[model samples]
Target: MTDKPLGRSAVYTVLTTGYTTSTGPGVAATVSYVSDRDRHVIVDPGMVAHRDRILGPLAELGLGPDDITDVVLSHHHPDNTMNVGLFPEAWVHDHKAEYRNDQWTDRDAEGHQLTESLRLIRTPGHSPEDITLLAGTADGVVAFAGDLWWRPDGPAEDPVAPDRDDLRTSRLRVVAAADVIVPGHGGAFPAGEGVPL
Candidate 1:
C-alpha cells in the first residue's frame, strides 16, 4: 500500500512528549493532536504527569476538550488509553471498532480513513491489536506509531511484543511509508537510517 499525496494536508501538533523509565515505574504515552478540515483528532491521549500537559497545549491551539471530534488508541494498554475520558464528545477509534456514546460499530482498522488525509492501518506487534495512524501532512506522511517504537532509537527490540517478527515487518513497512515517526513514548524523529530494522 502507498500513501498518495493529498491536495489538502492535515496538520499535526505534538501535545506532549512522553517517557518511560528503564528500572522504575514512571511512564507516559506521547500524545498528539491532528487537524484536517472539520476533524479534530487526539491520538493516544494516555498517561501523563499532569492533565495540563495535554490541555495546555490544546488550549494554545484554540481548542478545548469538547472540540475534539475523535480519539484514537493504537492498542489497549493502560499507558496508552488512560485519559480518554477527557474527550467525552469524541468518537473513540481502536483496531477493531469505533465507539461513541452507546454505539459500538465494528470495523477493521486496516486502511480505515478518518478524513481525507488521515487513516489507520493495522500494525500489530507491540500488541496484537496495535494500529498506526498515518497522516498526510504538508511535511509528508507522519506515522503516529504506537509502541511500534517506544522511541526513535528503536530500543532496538521490544521486550513485551507478542510477536517480534510481526513487529519487525511492521517497522519496515512504517519506515518505508513515513517521513517522520511520532513514537509511542518519545518525541518525533525522522524515519530511516538510525531506525531499528
Candidate 2:
C-alpha cells in the first residue's frame, strides 16, 4: 500500500488479502516489489485475489507484466506464489526443493546472483524453500527477508515462526549484514545499533 526508496532500488508493499480468526479480521499476506532502471522484480506476488493490487503499482512505474524480468518467490506458500500465472514472460524462480510445477525456469541450490549487486540467499527456516534477497546498494546491504521473522513492536521472538533455530540464525545473519531490511509483511526498517525494532 506504500512505496519508498531503499538505497538504489525503489521498493513497495501491497496488501493482498485478509482473513478472520477467532479474534477478528487480520491481514493474510503482503507482496513486495523492488526495481531499478534495468530490472524489475516482484517478490512473493501474493494470491490471485489481489492481482490488480500488484498490476496497478507496476502500471504506475510505466511497467507491464512483460517488463518484469524476474518473478522471485521466497517460498511455495499459496499466499506468496498463487499469482505466478500473472507474470508469464518473466523468468520465474524459487528454491529447487520448492519448485512444484514446470513454470519455474531456474532453481538455485546455494543462491542465484540476479545482478552483480543483488544475490539471493537460501535462508530456509520459515519454510524449507525460503530465500532472502540481498542487494548491495549505495547506502549499504539491503535484505529482503521473506517470512524469516515477522516484524514485532520490538526485539522479541516471533511466536508464530515454526523453526526458531533457523529463524534465529537467519535473523542474526541479516542483522549483521544489512543496514536496511524490507520484511515480508511490514514496512522497511533500519537494523543495527540505535534502532532496535
Q: Which is the leading candidate under lDDT? A: 1
Query: In candidate 1, what are the lDDT values of residues 1-197, reduced to their tens digit?
Result: 48533534899999999998441289999999999989999999999999999999999999999999999999999899999999999999999999999999999999889887998889988999999999999878999998999987877779888889999989988888889999999999999698986
Residue 163, model 1: Cα distance from true site in angstroms: 0.8
Q: TM-scores for all candidates?
A: 0.96, 0.76
Cα-based lDDT at residue 134, candidate 1: 92
Error of 2 at 156 (Å): 3.9
* Cα-based lDDT for every prediction: 0.90, 0.63
Residue-level error in angstroms, candidate 1, position 145: 0.4
Task: For model 1, give the 10-residue run with minimal summed lDDT.
Answer: 1-10
Winning model by TM-score: 1
Off by over 4 Å in 2: 1-25, 97-109, 152-155, 193-197
Task: Give the clashing pairs for model 2.
Answer: 1-13
Candidate 1 collision pairs: none
Provide the lDDT at 113 for model 1.
92
Give lDDT tens digits, candidate 2, residues 2-72. 11123354443333322212111343445666665576777877654456877886787788888878777
Whole-model lDDT, candidate 1? 0.90
